[model samples]
Target: MNRIYLPLAASLVLIVSLALVEGKMRDRWGTPGVEAAELGKRFDQVPKKIGDWVGEDLPVEEVTRKTAGAVNYVSRLYTNSKNRNTVNLWLIIGHSRDVCRHTPTVCYPSQGFRQTGDPLKHHIDVLGEEPAEFFTATFSKEDPSGRHLERVFWAWNHPNTDIWEAPDNARVHYGLSRALYKLYFVGNVLNDENTIDSSASVDFAKLMLPALNAALFPEKIADTVQSDIQPAGDAPAEEVPAE
Candidate 1:
């Protein structure tokens, strides 16, 4: 009887864990800012093209904050984090307690960073919908040392749907997401904060451009073979000049 009950209890524990994860993902549909319900409307529209979305730019406070290896260019009143190594991960880019100022009420949507360890969990932060000027404002590495500088673009959209389940364009957008994820992993290996020139991100942008542009992207993991990326011996640090 005791042995049988142990198995039943273990199964129940697994079920509970899965349920919590599922619930968290469901909670974060799009970027979370102020405009939650309104953003949901446009986000659910089934995107046509990248340009079709992220149209223009509205007024934001333009705040900057530094973390251990990452810096967030965000609005002052609209961001927070509880990760130990997160450093100061959110840069506030807006004033008046809002990330999006044009709306004067709703918050601008900002998306990215699925629940820490859960890549599938997407959190939606929104401001407004129509007359919405969405621009890809990227943040550069605030600290140069011990960081692999990489740029991250943000916008508010529902995270409920899996980009893997979306159309080709979704994969394209996800390609960028994957690129960012890779940079993060590599940054950890190199023990450096990833930084990029705001205007010159297009250079590193090519890192994942192929997949983003490809209609049928490869499902396999890239660079499976360990080749030249590894260092042979202890040598001088590789100094990469600005692109």
Candidate 2:
């Protein structure tokens, strides 16, 4: 009877310990229970006219859309009338933080493009908005037909203040909370003489980021507008060099 009681007591203790650990983990890393469908935004409302550039919605392929695993996304091409330089915009609100790995680093390589170099980090201060941090990469693919070079800039945005390229940061900020957002800008310089000029992406972000912020955080727009008028010392500043 003593042996039986001792075994039962030990088993009960183990169960209780496991339960406590599970609870703590859930508190620290649990994803929100909200469905992605419920968080869809009206990307259709993004203005076609952003500054001097005009945008047109582009169709995302069925296979690509399904592979993205985003609850919703917006794909568009914006071209400046002055220079006719074009940039492609893609904003995705993923179904889960797992989408962090869906960056061009993986996708482009899989699609047959070889990555050219390490991703470059950049910060741009958009007027009337907080500084945005992003990563840029260039990919080149050669085939029997020809070679193609594409440059992509992207970031993970949070509802709160921080924006960065670190996946762990995004996981902690949005994955734990079960809300994730990502912005991507891609430009094809396949035919251009300057294949390394990445400024087109920056220029597009400058004009379109405001609309993106409004869509993602409509409640924060009034506060953002107020900040847009703040004095220089206290205001968010741009670190990007002039092109």
Candidate 3:
């Protein structure tokens, strides 16, 4: 009887300890002050014209927006003026838990689109800043209209740091933030065999990063590039007529 009671007591104490730890974690990482309205305004400020890509708004149904838990979002179709290639951009800000669960791996399958392969991490070299990383994947569906294919690149950005990250587990990585931003760059896959290096979506991402930085981090922007400059020191002595 003594042994039985001792083990039961120990188990109960372990459960209580685990519960307390979970509560503390939630308190620390679950709630943050994020202004949804101000973030919405900034989302609107991203330019419609990024380099040669011109954009037009795409309507998002109210029901869908609610389902997505989006505080604010932009859905747009951008077309290149030079080659007529097009890409769709979806950018949204919302609670981290809500936004992180809606990745293409889950959403595309529910819509009857089969993933072509495992998603890969792709890095884009943002001019004058650190390279941004994203997850890229392709999916396809067949229907009365015909077979359709899409390639999508996605990543998350924390509002305070303004750095884009593609974590293996975004929900955990961003769980502390009250609000998070998720961006998707999607384009039709013309050929499954072709490498994505030259895709319009990739090119557009390179062109749009600077504009996005300006819109999202206006206060943080600075001229990082150095032009012609003379070394700081006393001016060179004037050439004298001496030998």
Candidate number achieving the greatest TM-score relative to the actual structure: 3
lDDT of 2 by residue, 170-227 (tens): 4444544345667888987645435333467777787788777776677687675787
Model 2 quality (TM-score): 0.72
Better of 1 and 3 by TM-score: 3
- Per-residue error for 37 in candidate 3, Å, reads 2.8
- TM-score of each candidate? 0.19, 0.72, 0.78
What clash count does candidate 3 reach?
0
Stretches of model 3 off by over 4 angstroms after superposition: 1-34, 222-243
lDDT of 1: 0.26
Q: For model 2, state the Cα shift of residue 243 in Å.
A: 62
Q: Cα RMSD for candidate 1?
A: 21.5
User: Which has the better lDDT: candidate 2, or candidate 3?
Assistant: 3
lDDT of 1 by residue, 40-90 (tens): 232222212232112122233324122111112212111112221211112
Model 1 shows how many backbone clashes? 52
